[model samples]
Target: MTSPSFNPYHEWLGIDPSISAPDHYQLIGVPRDEQNPETISRAADAAMSRVRQVRPGDKSQEWARVLDELREAKSCLTNQGR
Candidate 1:
């Protein structure tokens, strides 16, 4: 039998599977109304680091995509003009 699939968003980030597409704030573990760039950056960095640490070696592509999503979230939340 094949092994079960891994969902980093749910398993690693604790995001609900129902949320197929979590927003930038949700992805970064910040309040939706948070307006501090430093907080947003720090949250994003921590999330990225966490993902990097627990990433499965066989799932490099999936982890890369997650990292990209984290980067995009950080950019969108921190820039405020993007």
Candidate 2:
């Protein structure tokens, strides 16, 4: 029998699937109105580090996508204008 599917978001990041699409704040584990760049940066870095530990094996592409999302979240949250 095949193994059950793995969801990095839920299993690794503790993100709920019901979120469907998490905003930058949600993805980085920050408050929606968080304004401190340092806080955002720290949260993003921690999230990226955690995701990097996941050994997806055949799901390398999905792992890359999650990493990209974390990168984008950091960029968006740390942008002064955003």
The candidate maximizing lDDT is 1
What is the Å distance of residue 21 in model 1 from its true position?
1.3
Q: Rate the local accuracy (lDDT) of all candidates.
A: 0.85, 0.83
Against the true structure, candidate 2 reaches a TM-score of 0.85
Task: Estimate, for each residue in 1-82, the C-alpha lDDT of model 2 and write its tens digit.
Answer: 2135566677668888666567788888899989999999999999999989888777787789889999999987799795
Model 2 deviation from native, Cα RMSD in Å:
2.7
Off by over 4 Å in 1: 1-5
Encode model 1's per-residue lDDT on 15-71: one tens digit a residue: 887776788998989999999999999999999998988837777777788899999
Each model's Cα RMSD: 2.5, 2.7
**Least well predicted 10-residue stretch by lDDT in candidate 1:** 1-10
Off by more than 4 A, model 2: 1-6
lDDT score at residue 16, model 2, on the 0-100 scale: 86
lDDT of 1 at 50: 88
Give every collision pair in model 1: none
